[model samples]
Target: MDPRQLARSSVPRSLPEARHLRQDDRFLLVTSIMPKNPAAVAHGPMLIGVTINVLLMGVIVMQAYEYFTSYKRRDDRYLKSLVVFVFCANILNTGFAVADVYLALINHFGDVQYLTVSTWLFVTDPVIVGTVACSVQMFFAWRVQVLTGRWYLGLLTASLALGQLICAMLMAWKCHQYPAWADFVKFTDLIIAWMTTTILVDVTITIILVWYLRRHKTGLEGTDQVVDRLIRLTVQTGMLTSVWALLDLVLFLTQPTDASHLIFQIPMVKMYTNSLMSSLNSRPKPKVFSEVTDNIHSIAKFVNHRTTMQDGTMQFASSLHPEAAAHLERHELGEFQKKTIEAASSGCKGDAKTGWDNAARAI
Candidate 1:
């Protein structure tokens, strides 16, 4: 064999060996380090936690805007205090969420096991979210009490809210003790209790409020329309919160290891806050029904608190239904006031009192 031909053949053999050596080195490098778990990588807890934090930040902005804009509009001191508390809680939640993302993603990147370990930041979520949730529930409970005149039902709802808060706080304390996200299943009982109470309170409030509004739907077209709107609003807000809580509970119970529940958990507080703010801000304007609905002229039937008989002894009759009195008080103008305001705005030329009386008597 020629020396050059032999050398070329040797070069090919050496090339193969070199390639094998390189492949072995790469294999050693890959295997010596931990092989990444696709499941773990794909469903990174940090991914869910951080994504939720972003969403939470957006919601916090919404909450701030709502508070500032409605501050002048809301005069109820109690409600004002609750709003302040929710705003503060929302801020605290955002802070905790930021810390959660930083700890899980930035501080311990690729250390996926640490993601299963609960930290101080992770536990704080239940506390802050629970506080906001319970406060909102109680506020609606109070409304139920006022509208339905059923103190027992209101107390029941409030008590349920308190129960949920206790369970949530308990869960937080437990998380702080364990500090392991994987071990969350150990506290399944507390989770069930907390989520159950929340769902019950939401549903109870919705049912009672809706029933009361439906019952108070005075046959008059305008009043009935207002009642219908109120019913729809009640269902919408109540269902949204309750449904989220229920989903969270279901996912937590079924997939304790997976962070799937975080999807519902993250935005839960925002739902509660937005629902409360929406209801408060949407206080019906009397003009909505009185001015817009042409059938309001039928209200003349219920006008005039006083009637004169043949004997001329003055008699006062209230046309308001006891069940509807609260609803009407909130949204409807008194007969005299309605007539006077309508007359003034309409530029009707007449003695306002006389015209109101005449209209009332005609009914």
Candidate 2:
């Protein structure tokens, strides 16, 4: 008769049939309610990267604290200022990164159109990263010159550092021009150049430092040990940044559409700052040489020398023989003095007597 009665008649009459129909409806509803966005492919990696970046920032803060507190009086003013500038830059970059993700995922939730494009905050990452990388690289370049006395090596390193910064800035501009994440592929050449220069600078610095240290190694165990430690630190810090940059490039090239590269890219800046801090903090402590100084003083009795203490500074004088002064000058002790002064200027603090002993034994 009526349409309503006819529709009711079509329903399953048995309890088992009705239960199956209910289960089918439930399955359909669940499937329809599932999110359609490719969140796992695009956003998951970003969240993970940000988390890691924050963790590393904590480490940087701790290192910065140690540097400031322990080396405040000893470190040069310019070097301390550099650390402060780098630390501030890192904080700014991290803030920009957090804002970038927050605006896209949290603030604009369910807005698929907004997530497709990056904001200005997202582009600041490259600029800030470039700044920090250039600063640290240039510092190392100066170190290279100081250690090797070759201006060309320092100039080459500085040039490469500047090149990478230029590439990074260009990449940032390109990102600003094409805000859509999909269009990042358009700047493939820029990405390649930027990462390539970064790796080149790192490798160049590492080679120069390691070569100089190895060449200057003295036969004495104490001096050679110092040189070996420097070599190891140089390799570890330099290769770490290079390998990470290479990995970021590889991931971007291989999976251009996916956001997997963000994982390495976000944390890359921290690696530079950490490496610099590690190098600055690795200098030998004065307390480590107390026993060595005692032994050295005991041996000094046999050499017929006079030591004068003035203003808390020890001065070794050849009072018994004027020829001893000429003999010391003939031994090229100036080179050793230059190195010691360089170390002190670079914020490395150590016992003066111990350094003298090491230098004398090497000679």
Candidate 3:
């Protein structure tokens, strides 16, 4: 009469009993339909995902610091916009990690009593991926907008992002409708990645064209120099990101689940490498760079002062003018010349045939 006794007394399905076995299969299929169990959360896949998010967050923090310290007014906009895109993208990924953790904690299953058990995956995964994809596209659009001040290209980015978002939503919808929509997940992930990569590239090229047009129109040497450098930097970074993205897409799309892990490893390594490289690039070595620059400036100022005095470019027309002697005396410089003067006074500096003057001779 006890419930436990009743459950124990129930007939077990034999392998030959198709209907009973079906029922058994449906019951035991919990593992198949399940998203993740708490124990599963401790596995390698979850660890890898967590590591990725933490690493990405580290890079974001480093870049955010770089952005704050970057003093150049022009570079601020592009750099900050890109940083924002990266920041948001990383956040979206972190959100996915959290969702996965929750799913794992709950031991996600399609046929669970609670409808939310599987529906959460349908709603969350696509949204995270979609936001990141569209945000990256917009980041490129922002770059193009600044370079050309053009609206049309930005509009194109917006349109493409909107379309991707819609597809992402549909991907979720289909999954929600049919619990076995594995293809929906694959399709949605691949499409967004492909579109994101394509649009970013296209928008970048459009930006380059705009820069070329502007540079050619105006004979602006100074502006041209900076833009040329920007083009090179962007291309270098973009190429690296594209390479990683392509590898990820190929692995995710073409490989079977078990084999996919190996293929995906390449991209994961690339991602970590990129984070390191990007951090190095963005980090300001202020002491080294600034000290070197200062030394160069000092040397340049020394050379110019000497040249101007020697050539009378910084001289007096008449001895009656006090400022001329004062200016000349300024060019003469300081006591650090002791060694050079001593060497010259000792007749050990500069060969006469070389036509170079010693500090002793000048003084």
The model with the greatest TM-score is: 2
| lDDT tens per residue, model 1, 1-363 | 332232333333423653344444544443344334422532354457557656766766775675556454534466677777887777777777777667756776646456547677767788888999999999888877766657899899999999999998998999888776666778888889899989998999999988877765557776566667778888999999999899988988777556678777765777788778767656534335334323334443443323333443223344333224323324222243444334432322433344434433221
Query: How many clashes does the backbone of model 2 have?
Result: 0
lDDT, candidates in the order shown: 0.65, 0.72, 0.43
Report how far off residue 120 is in candidate 2 (Å).
Answer: 1.0
Off-target runs (Cα >4 Å) in candidate 2 are 1-38, 286-363
Please report the TM-score between candidate 3 and the true structure. 0.47
Worst 10 residues of 2 by lDDT: 320-329
Clashing pairs in 1: 116-181, 118-179
| Per-residue lDDT of 254 in model 3 | 62
The lDDT leader among the candidates is: 2
Please give, for residues 235-344, the per-residue lDDT of candidate 2 as tens digits.
Answer: 99999999999999999999876779989888889999999989877753334445444433333442224445566444544331211211121223235444433332
Model 3 segments more than 4 A misplaced: 1-47, 69-89, 102-123, 149-151, 178-228, 256-363
| TM, every model | 0.72, 0.74, 0.47
Error of 2 at 231 (Å): 0.9
Model 3, 191-284: lDDT tens per residue?
Answer: 5554454445544544554454445322234333433444455555555655555555565456433223322322232242343235334432
